[model samples]
Target: MVHKFAIEQGALIEQLPEFIQSHFNMVIDVKADGPCGYHVVAHSLGRGEELEFYSKEYTFSNIHQTLGSIYPTPSEPVGTKHWMSMPSMVEAIANAFESPVFFFSPNLFSIMLPSLLSAQSNSRNIYCISTKYTPFCVLNDEPYEFPAPRYLKNWEKSATKEALGWAQLYSPNFQKAHD
Candidate 1:
């Protein structure tokens, strides 16, 4: 799919723009490694421009303190684990490309509030991507069966304290994290 997006097929070569077609041909004929994702940076529409992007997977896990604190439920329901969806990934990429923005996953705040506080800058816009149901443990009247003991509303205070130290560190911000 990406190849088609970048280059034309063998028989459809004539349909493509000459410059792009020629570039693709030369790249395939000369370049040793197969199709690698790289920015086609050109300063004067020719060569020597600044363009870079990483196509590697960045894995995230809870920090030690967080793990120890949430000992009772090492793993919560849907939202507890480190899972990045397609839209969140796209938003991160867009933010990275557009401005001096700090993209953080929802769980990171509860886990690394102090570190984030320390690294905070005036110009940086911190964007946290989260879903309502995932991070939020709602005991509404909806028809659903939770696997484990869902933390009742009463346990929220202590649990937040134990798992995140959420209120103590971030306070008002912690409220957002909890939500």
Candidate 2:
């Protein structure tokens, strides 16, 4: 849905990796108010921009921890406004949906799931890209996707070790590759 907080995504579209540009057509800007990462997932699922994992009883599984190691408190409680929810909420959704969730940041990314083997067989996978504000872009293609990136951004190129560390936080799979 169109809104004031959506990203313009003009020239930035051209700068995307050739693989991404080839796989999906750039859609309209997703509202950047807050939970835009969730929005992308919902869209990928063909459910439009609505993700309602909260306001239900099942989403509170071991989620009383910090977000990304810096936030003082845990993610917001249920029934909060759409734009007020945090990105980590996707963790609960991924668990509930029994799928893997990818946190795609500017220079780093993370693959989070309860079990790598189980998530690999999941029918529904999630990808969220953290932009300057929130996750505004969604990559929803298969076959062309690779585990280790052939080309990374300038920031990631200089810090491959650091980037792999960020990925290892959620998946021991990264540990094997790094080792």
Candidate 3:
């Protein structure tokens, strides 16, 4: 669920950090649904249907091969944990599309960064942005937005005493180490 909208210049004057709120007049809010990550990658690469089918097949094959003996048969509701393997999914997407993958998450940066970095290679370019979510003024019932340029630029500025502080500390060294 990717949503695109425009924000009034000073709509969020008192809410978001000045740096994050000022970077863009337009914004995209990607809802953090179960398949949100996959959808983002597929849509970005312009391989929507193909990626979806590949994901389904890949997940089913991996699950059967890796955990078939343990589970024996499928559970009642079906366990989706194996299906949502981010590292494997991202790797598959990158390889299939033959393009760099950029993952930006408001949280889960620390947990995801190491694996993504280790998986990086001369042929594969994987970038991760772990930052705090900024609330770009509410309009009707739509979800919040994260201004990309502002969020990326925030990496270079002073760390805010909020959720983003830890991200700032980790980002520079993490990027340097990985790159």
Worst 10 residues of 3 by lDDT: 135-144
Please report how far candidate 1 places residue 78 from its true position, in Å: 28
lDDT of 1 by residue, 20-119 (tens): 2332222111111111111111111122222211222222243344323422332442232333332234323322332111122223311222211222
Index of the highest-TM-score prediction: 2
As for model 1, its CA RMSD to the true structure in angstroms is 19.9
**Per-prediction backbone clash count:** 0, 0, 0
Model 3 lDDT tens row, 13-47: 32334534343343334344333444444444334
Worst 10 residues of 1 by lDDT: 137-146
Off by over 4 Å in 1: 1-111, 114-123, 128-169, 176-179
Those runs of model 2 whose alpha carbons end farther than 4 Å from true positions after fitting are 2-28, 51-87, 120-122, 148-179
Comparing 1 and 3 by TM-score, which wins? 3
TM-score of each predicted structure versus truth: 0.17, 0.48, 0.32
* Stretches > 4 Å off in candidate 3: 3-27, 47-88, 104-131, 134-179
Tens digits of per-residue lDDT for model 2, 1-179: 53444445544344454434444444445656454554566665556664343223235444423222222223442333434233556555555555556555556555545332232332555666655654455556552233523222342344334233333333344333344
